[model samples]
Target: MIKNYRMVLEYDGSRYDGWQKQGNTEQTIQGKIEQVLERMTGQAVEVHGSGRTDAGVHALAQVANFHMDGKMASKEIQEYLNQYLPEDIRVITLEPAKERFHSRLNAQEKTYLYRIEMGERKQVFERKYIYGLYKSLNVEAMERASAYLTGEHDFKSFCSNRKMKKSTVRVLKEIEFEQQGSRLLIRYTGNGFLYNMVRIITGTLIEVGLGQRKAEDMKGILEAKDRNQAGFTAPPEGLFLEQVRYNV
Candidate 1:
């Protein structure tokens, strides 16, 4: 009998193509996990994720589900998968999930973090995970700008040009900007996000920080509902899928 299980995953996306499996692409987090599953169970398995993160984007807590015929405990599967998976990808934990539990459908909230380094000298060790901007940023201005993004809004202006079937409306529960030493962190938690929403928001916040845009301009941008009204999409390297929350 096939049993459904949920797994928590973490990966350093620097070397990954992305989280989803594309035709003929072997360098994705999903493909890698599927390969390991096939090896362990000797059967094909389809893993469903909460969402697909873009290439070069890291994840601290990504949730996925799959069905398998194995009888091994969740802990055993976790240990075995970690041993075979590449260093960049790790299976953090596993749990038995209801057969009807769908990772994407069950997810209630997601939090993302974008890291920027505001300084002349970039840390060599952390360059792979952060975006370095030499210009001084106005954190106070960015914070005020971010506040405009909180609450329900039509975020079409912040989304990418890619076609999406779902509604563009989203509820942003929290948006904050903080500076720790040389790193600037932009954190956001929302019920859901449109394609490239976080990246675009980060870009707009950067523009506000640079004094090129005013905090009040965000209202006009959202009202415009045009993608061009928002700032450029921030780099994927600085973005992370921080957490996924699900209703039990």
Candidate 2:
């Protein structure tokens, strides 16, 4: 009998191309996992991720699922994966999942975290994960700008895909900011996000904080629906796929 398995993974994406497996290379998170599974099961396996994180982006809790013909115990599978996988990738948990459970399709919500360091001094250990800005930003202005972004709207201006044929509308449930000294943590929770949408929003908010744009300008940018109207796309290093939520 075939058994479906679910896993929660955490990976440092600095060296990975992304979550999706490509034909040309095996330097992706999905590719690495699939290769290991194929070796373990002695069969080709297709592993599906909750979403595709951009290159250089990290993940604290990325969900994935796959099917195997043999009945391997969850603990055994997890141990085998951890043993064979690279040091940067880890299988936090592995368990039997419902036959129809799909990590991407059944996702109800996803939260992404972006980290910014606003100071002259850069962190040595966290240099790989945080975005460092030389100057401090106006926190109040960023907050006002974030308020405009928290709602259902056409976020095409913030999307990087110009030839996107599908709908660009998305529901941004929340945008919260927490400041700790020179470090700023921005959290975004949404039903789904467009390609580079969160990074673009972060850029726009940074512009507002930098006095390049007013907080109220966000409304017009959203209405314009033109990608050029948005700010520059923030670098991928600061972004992390924090979590994925499901109804069950």
Candidate 3:
């Protein structure tokens, strides 16, 4: 009988292209897992991810699902995947799922984290995971700017895809910030996000923190609905797919 399985994955995406498989490359998170599953089952296997992360982005609790013909214990399958997959990527958990369950279509919420190092010192081991800025950012100003971003809005200005036909509206539930000495962590929870939306919003907030832009300007930018009205897109190294939430 064909059985369906769900798995939570964690990957250091620095070395991979992204989460999705592309025709041009096999060095993607989804492609790697699919390859291992195909080898194990001796048939083609397709893995579906909750969402796609950009190049060099990381993930802590990405969810995925796949179907296979044979039966195998979840522990054995996890172990096999961990053994064959690269050290940077690992399956955190695996279990049986409903036949109709899908990682993407069933996802309700996603939280992304962006790490910023606000100091002149260079990162040693964490260089590939953090974005470094040589100056301090005003946390208070950033918080004020974030208020305007919360709630449902058409975030067309923040998206990178110029020709996107799908709706650009998304419900950004929250934007929380934490500061630990020189490290600043920003977490964004949303029902859905447009292409490069988080990065662009981060860049806009950084500008507000730097006094390059005012917090109140966010409303105007949102109304403009033009990508050029938004700030630059932040680097992908600092972004991570922190978590995905489902109703269960």
What would the per-residue lDDT of candidate 2 be over residues 75-146, giving only the tens digit for each residue? 999999999999999999999999999999999999999999998866899998999876789989999998
Error of 3 at 34 (Å): 0.5
The C-alpha stretches of model 3 lying farther than 4 A from their native spots are none
Tens digits of per-residue lDDT, candidate 3, 1-248, equal: 88889999999999899998999988999999999999999999999999999889999999999999747888899999999999999999999899999999999999999999998875799998889876899999999999999999999999999999999999999999999889999999999888899999999999999999999999999999999998989999999999999987
lDDT of each: 0.91, 0.94, 0.94
- What's the TM-score of every candidate structure? 0.96, 0.98, 0.98
List ranges where model 2 is wrong by over 4 Å.
none
Note the residue pairs that clash in candidate 1: none
Over the stretch 42-155, how does candidate 1's per-residue lDDT look in tens digits? Answer: 888899999999889999999999999858988888998899999999888899999899989999999999999888967888888998887789999999998888999999
Model 2 vs. true fold: TM: 0.98
| lDDT of model 2 at position 58 | 97
